[model samples]
Target: MNPLLRLLVLALVLPAAACSTLSAQQRDRAIAIAAAARAPAVDCGQPDRCAEPSPLRALAGEAFAASAAAPDGAPHHYALLLDEGGDALLARVNLIRSATRRIDLQTYIFDTDDSARLVLDELLAAARRGVRVRLLIDQLSAIADLQILAALSGAHQNLELRIYNPTFNLAKPNYLHYAASVVCCFRRFNQRMHNKLLVVDEAVGIAGGRNYQDDYYDWDAQFKFRDRDVLVAGPEVRTMERNFAAYWDDRRSVPVERLNDVARRLLADGVPAMPPARPAHPRRVEALSQAASDPETVRTQLVARAMPVAAVEYLADLPDKHHGDSALEDGVGAAGLAGLLAGAQEEVLLQTPYLVLSDHALEIFRGLRGREAPPQVRVSTNSLAATDNPIVYALTYKYKRRHVRELGFDLFEYKPFPADPPVDPALGGWWPGQAPADAPDPEVARSELPGGSLGGSRGSAGEAQVAAKLRTETRPSLLRTSAPANRPLPVTGAGPRMGLHAKSMVIDRRIAVVGTHNFDPRSETYNTEAAVVIDDPAFARALAASIEGDIAPGNSWVVAPRAKPPVLSGLNYSVGKVLERSPILDLWPWRYATNYEFQPGPECPRPLPRRDPEFHRCYAPVGDFPEVSLGPKSILTRMLTAFGAGLVPIL
Candidate 1:
């Protein structure tokens, strides 16, 4: 290792020993925190052990929430839609800061940025207070930094860490990392734990798309998102906790201590002793407008109403209907509006960041468009300018104009928010779920329509005009800033351009299923996805209203010729559209594009492997694509990278 890198690792490994020169109050608080970590596990009836449900069992609306429950059972959970900014971010962060008894965190990706660090610090503080902290991060997404992990584990005896599907490289006949992943193909990659959850003291849970990253939390000053999350309590706590335990105990998970020496030391130090916690950051009730003054709606609406239900493990031998056994449910049909596209619904509104629609998805929408109601189907997504993944943009852009014209659905594309001029008076704070009257007139904001041409998807002139307005009216300029910017926003559009992350559809405010599943083929067929479909009109109405009133205007643009495709987004946008249109075409010659390949190993029934160079290249992208480093390769790194490649399929 380079001297600088070696020194850096050592610095992380050995931090300054706890300062002996501490104030008496500080010491007392620290000691008190230690005691709380030893409290007995909050029991929620041990989570419907040995029970399971069929994978084919579709839980429509009410049935989905039926599984949510608290240990004692009054539905104290809340299910408010998080389609706005500022308040929602604060609400979730506040919840994490206040968690006292135990914090169970799991995620596919956790970036090591300011927001991530801030939350990490909060977890550490809670751990010091005797709060038992157990964290499970997806090894595929979390680049293992042993030194950092070791230091963190060593700092708190109350914290337990584990990695889901880990890998490391090696040299010789085979890399150890490769071998690990090969074994995980069936047990790990096929069944990814894609759920992002934060459960605290059995009293609250936060489940949604937000990862532990600055961009996700809207902490980045340059660009921020208007995303959503459900802060749940009640019966749902039992279900989520049960789900968590299944993944926790799964054979694919490796206690992080096995890899980090410091983690081992911390575990050896033993659990701390501490007092039990009362509810912290409890839920609050109010009107949609009231959510502004009352931030507790997140907790009260989402977490407060959960009640327990049957527990289902990943590979448990449960009833065929609710079984969580296979990597993906094959052949069996999924319930809901599969072919219902033939029947007319008044309207269909679909928003997705990754839009890789399959034949089934296309047919459903088209069928709906042909119905008697001739429902006005409106689809919204980022213009080429806003897409984070250019390839995904390419895949979906191809159908923009065609869908709008042929399917008769209005298409809306988002343009960047305009720059606010210096000394502009409207530097006002926003209320949750309500657009301020002082804010721009909502009507004046145009509804974004798709571009005009069927084959050529480009923003309409109306879109260009609206884009200009956003730059001048809604967006604030980061350039000529008063302080150092974490990330600089584009000179045009509002702040930074953030992609649409909400994965849901509100059908006349009568039904909604909001979960972690994206509207892409990867999410549908390749990855394991979970969502809760809510049928209650009251709740669904609230969800729809939030999206329309709070989310639509500023974040999106209202364009004309809803028939046209949006503007050209460059290579990423073009290619992604082609891929999206061709479901069978999985491989392309792009460097970082997503590819669908057959799962590795003989366990999967498919075409047999061959060593032909052309054949291998085509399939290589499916499994462990090779990587060559720029710097001199070290023995450990080469091994670790090999290991990483082996596990790529599962990761």
Candidate 2:
């Protein structure tokens, strides 16, 4: 045998030979220790203070009351968009602090940064208050200290933690172990739990693209995520609760004690008190914590913004989505979006962090375009300059023709540093005239951006120039070298850049959907995703307005055909279209379309529609990639565009 072939066989066999699950005795010991430890009784005498101060609960009660009185029973929904980083963080904080009965959190990624630790500390406090708390985190991306996981396993009987789909039946697996597992069971190893959900007392639920990380909540100094979430309370919450239960009860969801790493520590040492979470951004955390618990802030800022609407539905794909090849199906997120787009009568708006589309999604667009009265479609996604995964962006870059001409899409790609991002009043924004109460600490108020830029919102022009020249900043990935196509993200800019991570759609200005699905091939085919659909015109319009802000001229770059090269314009487009149709061999440098920038002047104060005759007068072509340089990732992106089309389905 070849030396490499012989080594490959040994490598594949070693993981099975060396690895072990919880033995019979180990399992019995864990059960005994768990049985001996019981959670303390509730000590709280007042329920009101412990109650999360949300007017949505009252709205939900009124909905239920109306349902009982109606001729035909139908439920009502109270929902508000959590588009700002501060607001999303505040919702989670208040939810944890308010739990008197039970709290459940489900997310794909759980880091040990200041933001995640703060949430963990809050959950521990809730458990101490005798509120039952369960935390379900996917194994691949989550990083919990072994001692902490072991201590958490038995610290409070009221608090239970579980890991979903562990590759080696362990909380902490090394790179070699990860590689071996992939070679051994490729499909199962790739199956990740991508749902981001938080349900408090089964009365309120928050769902969207946020994971438990600093960037997701705008706490990261060097980078931040421009994401969105929906705080919902209605009959649909019951469905979310049931879906969480389904995941919790699934055999794939193993208790922390059952994991090899956590179990070993539990057997060696008795349960210890949870270590206090140390915050890197103490001033910011303190300010946010005050806002979350303050009656007036919760009442005025959050409660007042909620809209009471009718017909909200929660949809989730079960863990069986990865059982086998027989499990192949359009996950709920993909199917739900497809179904909603199919019903489009006049207009559709779609936004995602990733731009890669699955085949089913492509088919839906094709059918819609074939219609005699096809609806106008507008898409908002990350530009090469703004995306976390430039590799994925290459696939989108590979098919710009299909997205624009074939589908008739008015596509806008988000910028790395938008002039304005929707920020909470508690935190001032990029532009002036915001409420003056940003970070409480003057130095900290610069908000983690180096050289004192404010909260990664906006930076000096020179600072941005330096950042855009970045060639080697990497994205957050949990894989080793062997992982397919895993490479440092060609982040055009590094420090304090915000990327769009919200997955949402608005249809006909009458219905809206928000959830964790990226609408990319990975979310559509691989991950178990969930979403919320609301059929309320007013709420849909509000969601539409939020998306509108994102696609504004200063915030995004429009994707459109470049000015005809003045000669061979016909041959140029024809040849480019033919090359783009293939997944590979699309090496044409002068493509049909490129990103365009909006130049505002006194004559044109507002943005014009793409089809507007005067559109070209106000917009200037900004090249294929706006803020990017020819770096390694760019080279790889170029290479992938030319020859890597076959890697699309699993991106």
Residue pair clashes in candidate 2: 222-496
For each candidate, what TM-score against the reference?
Answer: 0.54, 0.89
CA shift of 23, model 1, Å: 45
Instruction: Output the worst ten-in-a-row residue range by lDDT, candidate 1.
Output: 420-429
Best TM-score goes to which candidate? 2
Task: For candidate 1, give the lDDT of residue 603.
Answer: 46
After superposing candidate 2, which stretches have Cα over 4 Å from the reference?
Answer: 1-13, 20-22, 34-42, 45-58, 325-334, 425-494, 630-633
Candidate 2, number of clashes: 1
Q: Give the least accurate 10-residue stretch of model 2, judged by summed lDDT.
A: 428-437
Residue-level lDDT of model 2, residues 1-651, one tens digit each, is: 466875796577665646656787986687556546646664465664265555544555666666667687778778988887777887788777876688999999888877788788888878876788899999987765887787778767788899999977888877667766666666787788999999987878999999988778866654567889998877778889999998999888999888776766766675556677777767667777777787676766677788988789887788777666346355353356678878898999998888888887888888889999999999999887777766778888888888998999999999876766654324422211111123335223444532244223333323223322444443454432433344334445545566788999999999999998766788877788988889999999999999988898878999987766534888878888898878758887777778888888997787887778888888898888787655454567778888878888778
Give the per-residue lDDT of model 1 (tens digit) for 1-651. Answer: 466865554454323212112445543443343334433433222232111121111111233454344354434334545543333444444555455456788776665555455456657666665667888876656523444554553456677667765543100111333333344333333444556777765655666666665445433433444456655544456666676776677665666544332233234453322222221111211121233223344334323333322321111110122234643244222223332223435655566655656656667776776666677666666544444443344444444434544566554444333111000011111211112222222122112222222111222322222222132111322111232121122233333334456666666555555556654545544454445455556776666654553223334443222111234435544564455345354232322221123233544333222222333333323211111111232232223322322222222
The C-alpha local distance difference test score for the whole of candidate 2 amounts to: 0.75
Which residue runs does candidate 1 get wrong by more than 4 Å? Answer: 1-76, 97-100, 169-192, 260-345, 418-495, 549-555, 558-651
Q: Estimate the overall C-alpha local distance difference test score of candidate 1.
A: 0.43
